[model samples]
Target: MKSVHMDVHALLDAGVIERRAAGFILPYDAVHVDFFLKAG
Candidate 1:
């Protein structure tokens, strides 16, 4: 999970990519992630 967190942090830190929203979705008893991003 730490690696994933770091990757997301890197994206958030980038200037060109905007992080609009992010969340987790639970389906089939598993965790799925959703990220909304926009390009500058």
Candidate 2:
């Protein structure tokens, strides 16, 4: 779980996610999300 959190933080650092008051959000659009998923 710590590693997962670290990865999320890394994503935040990379501007791949937006950290909100309550949670985080993947800022990519759905098409990019799909591409990212497949690319990953």
What is the lDDT of every predicted structure here? 0.57, 0.81
Clashing pairs in 1: none
Candidate 2 Cα deviation (angstroms), residue 32: 4.9
**Candidate 2 minimal-lDDT segment of 10 residues:** 31-40
lDDT of 2 by residue, 1-40 (tens): 9999999989889898899888998766752534334553
Model 2 TM-score (2 dp): 0.61
Deviation of model 2 at 10, angstroms = 0.6
Give the Å error, residue 15, model 2: 0.4
Best by TM-score: 2
Q: What is the lDDT of residue 7 in candidate 1?
A: 71
| Deviation from native of the Cα of residue 18 in model 1, angstroms | 4.1
RMSD, each candidate, Å? Answer: 11.9, 4.7
Q: Candidate 1 lDDT, tens digit per residue, 1-40?
A: 9998887677557532445447532223553568899999
